[model samples]
Target: MSMRDQAVVVGASGIVGQAVLRAFAETPGWDAVGVSRRLPVNVPLHARHVSVDLTDRDACASVFGAMKDATHLVYAAVNEKPGLVAGWVDRDQMQLNLGMLRNVLEPLQANARGLRHVTLMQGGKAYGIHLDPNLAVPARERWPRHPHDNFYWLQEDYLRERQPHSGWHWTVLRPRLVFGDGLGSNMNPLPAIGVYAALQKARGLPLCYPGGPPRVYQAVDADLIGRACVWAARSIEARNEIFNLANGDEFVWQNVWPVIADAFGMAVGEPQQQHLAETMPPLEAQWAKIVGQHGLQAPPRFREFVGQGFAYADFQLNTGKTGPQPPSLVSTIKIRKAGFTDCMDTEDMLRRWIQRYQELRWLPPRDG
Candidate 1:
């Protein structure tokens, strides 16, 4: 019905979803529509957003049914459980995720007759990281599916079963600790770390490392992942393939403390382990005071702005761990060989995204 490629980015408000929506909208000859339960507050490229609860099949039909021009789909929507990690193995959680994807896909497949490609988001958990911390370093796309109960398996299986009949090809991306432009996401570390830095600065304290042991970890910028989605959509080499992605760099939390501390205009304080899930959420009053003091536009409620981010931070940051953790690495050689050769410097990424939050007035500016 439309002249250009219509990219419907499901979960458009999420970190990766937003990035994908922005990339497609900004690219030549593409129109991107954001579909999510709630419209994103800050849409890149000023793209249009539609509110659709993916869990509601009838609702999905009502909305996606009207999007007959949709030519590409980026299925980044996810239903993470409370507490974040435990739900990875929960049976109901797996089925619910599969159902959500089915709801989105069935309606689209029925209406969007021209749909040519689909992208699904997966992460390190696919390698059994939640069940066993010592997963093989630099996990690859060609390896056997790790023996684990994950919602990723459910959704991938569904896609594989349905794709042969649907006239669409799909690509699955497994990224390491995805980071960038998300608010209150169940797994994003940006808001949690930003608030932590802000609260520390407000109290006249240096930035303290609240995480436990120092483990080398890798992260993929949401923007890179977004661009990758765009590339995957058009690249024949990416059809029906899976790729592991990252920034092609690694960092230790303790080592990066200085960069974050300097950004907050604070000195490095003594390292301490406080379960952010336990300590950070209970400080809503304190966060509100900081918000008022800085005149930040952040949501007054901690949960509204941070979601389960603090808990996810503890998990990703290795908070309370007594020793070094085996690095959770994944290979991007496949994606690069497939023609999407994109990378970002992790430290520069940290600097820029932190600055982006400040520029949005959602977090305090750097100290002078």
Candidate 2:
């Protein structure tokens, strides 16, 4: 709570972590650093960058030892395997993710005497949203844990059991679908949607809805998640609590399809089974052509830039082969009642981020 508090954001290159970095940079008297195996080329000048694999304990100790003055830690890093959903129940994935946090926290706890608060990012998956078709609507923080080998349970348990009794407090955030403009983020849906739209428009085709059955969903803007991180670290009421966050509204993709098509000046198409992992690899040449025609500055291998992000979008829209089920929602009342009232218009948030991708040449501009 001191004005000169310093914070370190693990997984700094990730969507949530990057947002945390920006939030800390904007604070009146906070100094922040981002930690990841690789640093983004365009990290904000006001922040410091540290490159160290959180899975490597000695490396973590070497890098974090210098941050004895750090007062806050935001752990937003994740280890995602090839199939995003399938990896949810994979024990190896769980161990890898748990190890990443342990490597960082063990070192920081030993070295940072000023460490006061720690924040962790969990998701709707914590409520069995990924593996259970019958997940209770409006998932709440107090719900009983679904019996699964989920890394969230492991990580949260570790944090609660390991935090030093006298110094630090911990909080967890469970956001549904997180949307942002991070190009290389394995979980970002924006570039996946953006590139898919650009490709469809380039081929004189409708901007199709590529995913599973039509079901309702919710999303939290990355910036909003970042704000919640800052608030949780600084507020007495938020400490030792887990809260669900979204844009404060729920939406069905079918209803928003037209809005997206219009944003790109394209026609809307019916929802279809489009597997991005199977489909995107074949579209690289076409993406290259679009890049050349538009003088865009995207990676020559578009698939590399977008990576598994598109697959994540596809999985999110239509929950794989299980067909449609009830809407997946998370109650945000806990965070709201606690006084972090920031909300985002989901449609507008998508539109703004898509336009930003165009301006940055990460995606082509809307074609006529």
Candidate 3:
């Protein structure tokens, strides 16, 4: 009820959640609780970590029973059943994602007496980006929710309905293609691109633009999203509103592909329209060999090493099916007007995170 001092980040291991944890560490007087199924190895020391399966209602209640001091909740967790993008419309995806949020929100709403704000994460799909590429360009937060079986709608509707009764205010942030540093983050595109480039260079192949057609694109840096979440919680103007979050810049694969290639010290191949899911599977053994040869961080399995981020990145980069449709973009004017003015250069954000992967040995060092 008093100005927020304690924040509970429900999906601490996720790209957005991890950024929230790190951001909270730098903000004075804010203690945080990080909730997730598994604790991330790199979580900030100032925050407390709780490993409670959010899908289990009793488990969630038990965890929050002791969190009465929590004044804010950031729900960044998502439940995407198998097949990634295909699961977007699956009934199970909707049920499971809605249920995960319910398990956490119900218990906290009942128990956390000081809770004042909630931040929920959504993505470009709300504008029908996954359903059809041509529906709209430069998606605005004011657009009607695209007709689809999306959990974003379900969760957002739930939040809006509860606002009058519940003491906490809420904000929904829709980001496109979040790029960040982390293993096991479902939507992180950096490690996937980092690994793909390293492997392709090893085989004496140029780093190719794997997706189809030149299309304009935008992305949100995980750190910026984290900051936005924090700002939304504290900014009175951000309450009960939806904001499209991005780096405030646009890019095309045809132009940035060569830059990515040069970062790995590989030649830039012609844009041939390849799918990484098809091409990267067979190279697992080769990745293992590279790990051994370079003494890189050897993950137990390649998939876990990069998480579903590999397939998700491929799904994101492929402009092939989009036809002559104009590029997908999201306007951030709403958030800027609300007074959160953070921005990042899209290309620099991607390249910087890839460099971080190399420094951490999560991906092999780029070739000289």
- The 0-to-1 C-alpha lDDT of every candidate, in the order given, reads 0.86, 0.83, 0.81
What is candidate 1's lDDT per residue for 1-368, written digit by digit as tens?
67888889999888889888999988888898999986776776647999988888899888988889989999999888887878778899888999999888888888886999999999888888777888887788889999878889899999899999788899999888887877777878999998888888887888889988878888889899989999999999999999989998888888888988777678999987799889887788998988888788889787778888998999988877786678777778899999988999888888888889898778988862
Each candidate structure's count of clashing pairs: 0, 1, 0
TM-score of 3: 0.95
Off by over 4 Å in 2: 1-3, 319-324
- Structural similarity to truth (TM-score) of each candidate: 0.98, 0.95, 0.95
lDDT of 3 by residue, 1-368 (tens): 43549988988888888888888766887887888897865788888899988888888888877688889899999876555777888987798899998888887888887789999998898888887878667789898778888889889988988889778899999987788765777677776777788788787888777776667888888899888988998999999999999998998877887777766777888766767767777788888887887778747366667777667877777735556547899899999999999999988886787777777777777763
Number of backbone clashes in candidate 2: 1
Relative to the unseen true structure, what is the C-alpha lDDT of residue 253 in candidate 1, on a scale of 0 to 100? 85
Write the number of the candidate with greater TM-score, choosing between 1 and 2.
Answer: 1
lDDT-sorted candidate list, best first: 1, 2, 3
Most TM-score-accurate candidate? 1
List the candidate 1 regions with Cα displacement exceeding 4 Å.
none
**lDDT top scorer:** 1
Error of 3 at 356 (Å): 0.6
